[model samples]
Target chain A: MPTRARRWHISWLLLAAATIPLLAVVSLFVGVSEVSLAALLSGQDGGRAAEVLMISRLPRTLALILAGSGMAVCGTIMQMLARNRFVEPSTAGTVESASLGILAVMLLAPGLPMFGKMLVAALFALAGTSLFLAILRRIPLRSVLLVPLVGIMLGGVISAITTFFAYRTDMLQSISAWTTGDFSGVLRGRYELLWIAAGLTLLAYFAAARFTVAGMGEAFATNVGLNYRRIVALGLLIVSMVTAAVVVTVGMVPFIGLIVPNVVSLALGDNLSKSLPWVAILGAGFVLVCDIAGRLILYPYEVPIGTVIGIVGSAFFLFLILRPNARVA
Target chain B: MIELKSVSKQYGDTLVVDGVDLTLPKGGVTSIIGPNGAGKSTLLSMMSRLLPMSTGWIGIDGLDVTKTRGDVLARRLSILRQDNHMTARLTVRDLVAFGRYPYTKDRPTGEDKVHVDRALGFLDLQPLADRFLDELSGGQRQRAFVAMVLCQDTDYALFDEPLNNLDMRHAAGMMRLLRRAADHFNKTIVLVLHDINFASCYSDHIVAMKAGKVAFQGAPDAVMQASVLTEIFNTDMAIHEIAGRKIAVFY
Candidate 1:
């Protein structure tokens, strides 16, 4: 390794840290309701400014941070376990499975609480991930590019099933809206499930080295005395739960997981322990900036964070596909 | 001693390794040589517990490999496979340091660092230790991986085709290093080698296999006969004595 790349740099981290609050502050001020600290302090705008900031702006900002960081971290774990960089919750049918779970709960119980629905979604997500992995292991992959294509196809199959079910149940509008991933509907008490995702992201950091070892492949990891199967199961569980929480709360952001980790790896290399904090920070920052852009693009109105992220993230994904010597596992 | 009792590997109906029973004594170099599809690598993998056996038991130092705890077995034995492709961009030193993982589990002690450095030095990888594995040539990467298994510092170290992709000078140098590893440290080294000449030169005992069965095994002097070499490989070989070592010329 180059001497510069060997040690983790404090300056880069400081810059990432500096960017989050800057973006968060910017996001806080650009909402549809023109609310400000000055207005709140003066007890003006009939006190509506404080409620809007507290209920809408603050919660939306926090949701963006949680969902962004959560999805990025989930992506990292999924990629490691799947042993393919392009595999993420959305691509691998995890998001679609969670949506299917939500749809099932809506039709079956019709009385399940939000937490109950999230639990069902998580279980379904886990199963979906396992199915994708089983399919992945069956085929001999000649190119790194084929792995994600398989995942996208798997996701497409599950998505078609979910869409068909939604249409039959007359819940297509509701399900379609949920899958689009907008922070516009985020308000007090609605985004709390995302806190579970935040907690899971911390657990991922604690197990970062194990996940890194698992990425080397089952045989190599077992030789090192790690239980390859157990670690993989843990990783999949983490990815599924995080996906379920984020999907349920803020909906699906297409490629935060894919783009953030690749960018971090290119800059810092792929040592998960060293690169994890950066992944988290950059994930949060990327979403915050994108969310800010969405809020401002039509000013006084808003573009869904998912729509903006989808547009920008796909562009970045295209660049990754077209880049020279694109070595992805 | 590593003991295998009726160990076999079956993929569906094909028996890759069938009823292999052998006890490899402790210390010195033992080479398993055979033609293609001879199950040499498969048997090595089974012994190292990298591949599960279908119908038998393997005991390393009296501890059943299938029953022993992973970390405990790790401390007792280690293995290096032919293909070490990985997605993580690890430096040679970082890769070697993983040998200490069984002991340190990600937290490297001063002693672990010492072992890592010593292994790196042993393989002449000190200069390339800081380089990323992908940046190095095949021979260099092979040496780096050897350094890692050496760093594991286990009593029993297994390598599958350790000399693949190496040129002549590096191949001989690698065999010499492995020979020293066995002789100087009294470590039990098991290797699967395709090059019979290298095995003949360095191995104290050679086991030849064909069609998933051990065809012949003995001290190099006994097993390297022209008739035995010709029978196992199905090619006529002329054995010549050079510097008191048997060299087979089959090409």
Candidate 2:
């Protein structure tokens, strides 16, 4: 590694940190009801300003960044563990399976707490991932890429099931709207659940070295004296928990995890501990930038951050698929 | 010492390796040579506990390979199979550094780095330490993988066809590396080789296996006779001397 590039890399992290206050300020200032610089400085003469800043705007914006960063990091770890750039929580069907659990619970108990639905979804997602992995272990697939295909097909099945249940309940519109990820609802009590995702991301950072070793190969990991099964299981739990928490709070933001990690590793190698913080920061910054773009594009009215991220994320995903030889270091 | 007793492996109705019993002493190089479909690789897999044996016990230094904690055995034994394809793009140093994982997890101590440096230097990988495995020639990649296994610094090193893709000179160099690993490190090496001549020259003990059974096992001198080689290989063979070591010749 070049010394300058390494130093610049650390500096880039500082640069990302520097963007946080700006994102928070932008998030605080822009919304359907805006409080200008004058009002924010005055410490809120009107209750409207306080409600929007404390109860709605700040929480929603913080939720967007938190879940956004968490899901991206989760996606990064899953891709490494699965050893395929194409494998993400979305593509591996983890998100869809989690959606299935949430949908099932919503239909069964109309009065269930959001956290309860999230836990159920997390369980289902974990089960789906285990099912996918079991299929991977049994199939005589010559390539690791074949393993995630099973996840795609399985994800489709869960998505279908979720849609079917939603349609039957006459709540398909509401369900899909929530599931599609709208930061427009980034308000107080509801969005604070995203803090759970932030916690999971930190836990993932702490355990990153284990995840990187597990990524090499089962034989190599076992030879290194790691409890391969347990490490793998823990990785799956993190992926599922982070995915479920984010999905429950902010719905799904595709591709942040899938994209950021690969971009980081192009310079950082496959060491997860070295690359994870960058993945988290880059993810939050990327989402914040997109959210800012959404705010300014139409001025008073706004574009969905999810929609903006979707367009960019989809384009990047296509680039990954079309590149015959992926350059994920 | 490593012991395999009544070890058999079966896939459905197919008995791949059946009722093999062997005691391997803790020293030098032992080559297991056999025909194709003779269960050489599968047997190696069983001994390393990579593949679950159908019926048997594998005890390494008196600890059972199956029942023992994986990390404990990992420190004692290392195996390199043919065709080590990986998707991770890694430098030669990164790959060799994995050998220390059984010791340091991912955080390498200074001592671990020293082991990595020694392994890289041992395989002459210093010049190519920064090159990616995919960017290297097949023989070079093979050497890189060998360096990783050797860097593992275990008492028992097992290789399945260490010479599979090597050209003539590289193949001979690989044999020498194994020999040096055995002698200098005081490690026991068990290999599955296709070339009998290389085995005759480099191995302290020769193990001839056929149809999942041990056809012959003894010192290289005892196994190098024309009649013994012919019966074991099921082909006509001749022995010639290249500096006093018996070299098998058949053509």
Candidate 3:
């Protein structure tokens, strides 16, 4: 046999490539009603089982892939922008700001279009990120470890403002549905908007290296002729916009960004130009696997993908923090 | 040519860099040497736009360094500071590849690869190109970072304490590299150096800074005199000519 055809970083690629399909297949088949390969291939909407598969499984699978991959890449981009591996759209306040924007639109103009809500959310998210970044520049902390803590606090303040308004309006339950971001609710037309996250992922891939270079401090990047601020602005725009789109379409799924990118960087190293494609793949795969497990782990009444991922993802992040070599970047 | 007009920087009540006007000729190496707390680094930082000036202006090659698009100014100028800690984990090779980002927009072509290779080789980092930065020795990483800056291939390169952590052999090697870069490439090299001997021996022009101002600006022969050295450093110093080079000893 040919010596196991090995390429540098190929094993991760192969593992990721192989897992994508298996998880995708399992995602389609392992939902509330167990639709086997035969049943899916038969193409008949027979009984309540077929409706469950058609309405639930198919859209859930697409949503899992989209939300998972979208959050992951968004996290990756935010981490690069803030130069801290711990930060993502969720932690950096983009998601919360977006949610607030959506809520405000929902309350202020109860019949606003989804795209309009997302646009408003995207603008607020971008503004929030810029606000946090601006405040961050004020504090002279050379250690980037402290920066994320500040962002989290900044996000907390914004979230408190959001929660206060959410309570006053008594739309908590309505907003909470969009907040938890489970794929179980995603179906045909409802979830199609998440494709925007997919498009934003492509934009991120195109700008990956520029973002990474900008990560290496302003002077160094500017010295190389990169418009450090402009590249950073574009990067932040992509991150906030993608984040807003994800939150608007699906809801808040935390740490997919933070965990996936860091893991890819650790395994793949920091050539983001090379790491981005893999980040996207692994991001989508990790989320899909988690969502599928969430569906199958409890059977009939599926556990929320975000909850399952939050529990597991936080553990990975904790491990990252405790890891001796972990520098938070 | 580089020019600074009435440049000043203040942090609260303390002025780090006082109002200063100066002109620097193009080409060759120029060293900015000053006593501790004299704002040599701050002055250099202001010149390169690394630290924005509080009041005044800087122009490089006829374009305002402050007003020009960062990438446009970047193609013409570059600066490397003392500390080069990075959040991104990168191999020596990957780190050098980033130097082309301003021009190539992160999509490095074959020509970019050649430039990366040349920078690595120039810094004697060919063997360690594949090695991770964290895996390398401190001095080695310092050299790797320097190689990344040099790989930028800009005409004007500014370095703040390039020899900070280098061993004797590497320190000599770095000075030689900077000189070769200036001479061979027709590049303008600006550096903030602590070692007066290195500046005296290797620099074409010298800017001795004191109390946030340019105390003196002249050729090494003029600036390295016993009186100038004593006045600049505020210590008694003796100057000796060895092999037609000025070497100052202060005890």
Highest lDDT among the candidates is held by which one? 1
Question: How well is each residue in A1-329 modelled by candidate 3, as lDDT tens digits?
Answer: 01253364567677877877778877777754567766656756465557776687778788778777777877777777777778888777788888889888988997988888888999999999998788777888776567778888888898888888989999888888887867777777777777887888888888777777877777777677777788878887888778887788778888888888988888767677778878888888888877877777877778887898899878987898888877635
Clashing pairs in 2: A60-A186, A72-A257
- What is candidate 3's TM-score against the reference? 0.93
Which is better, 1 or 3, measured by DockQ? 1
| Model 1 docking tier (incorrect/acceptable/medium/high) | medium
- Output the TM-score of candidate 2: 0.94
Q: Rank the candidates by lDDT, best first.
A: 1, 3, 2
Clashing pairs in 3: A75-A257, A225-B71
Write one digit per residue (lDDT tens) for candidate 1, span A1-329.
Answer: 33475444766788778989888888888877787879989987788988888899889999999889989988888888887778788889999999999889888987988899899999999999999999999999888889899989988999899989899989999988877888988899999999998999999998887888888788778888999999989988889899998888888888999999988877665667778888889899899988888889998788888889899988988898888768732
Q: In terms of docking quality, how is candidate 2 classified?
A: medium
Query: Candidate 2 lDDT, tens digit per residue, A253-321?
Result: 877877787787666666776678888888887887788788889987878777888899889877866
Taken over the whole model, the C-alpha lDDT of each candidate is 0.88, 0.82, 0.83
Interface C-alpha RMSD after superposing true interface residues, each candidate, one decimal: 1.6, 2.3, 1.9
Q: What DockQ do the predictions score, one after another? A: 0.67, 0.55, 0.66
| Better-scoring candidate (lDDT), 1 or 3 | 1
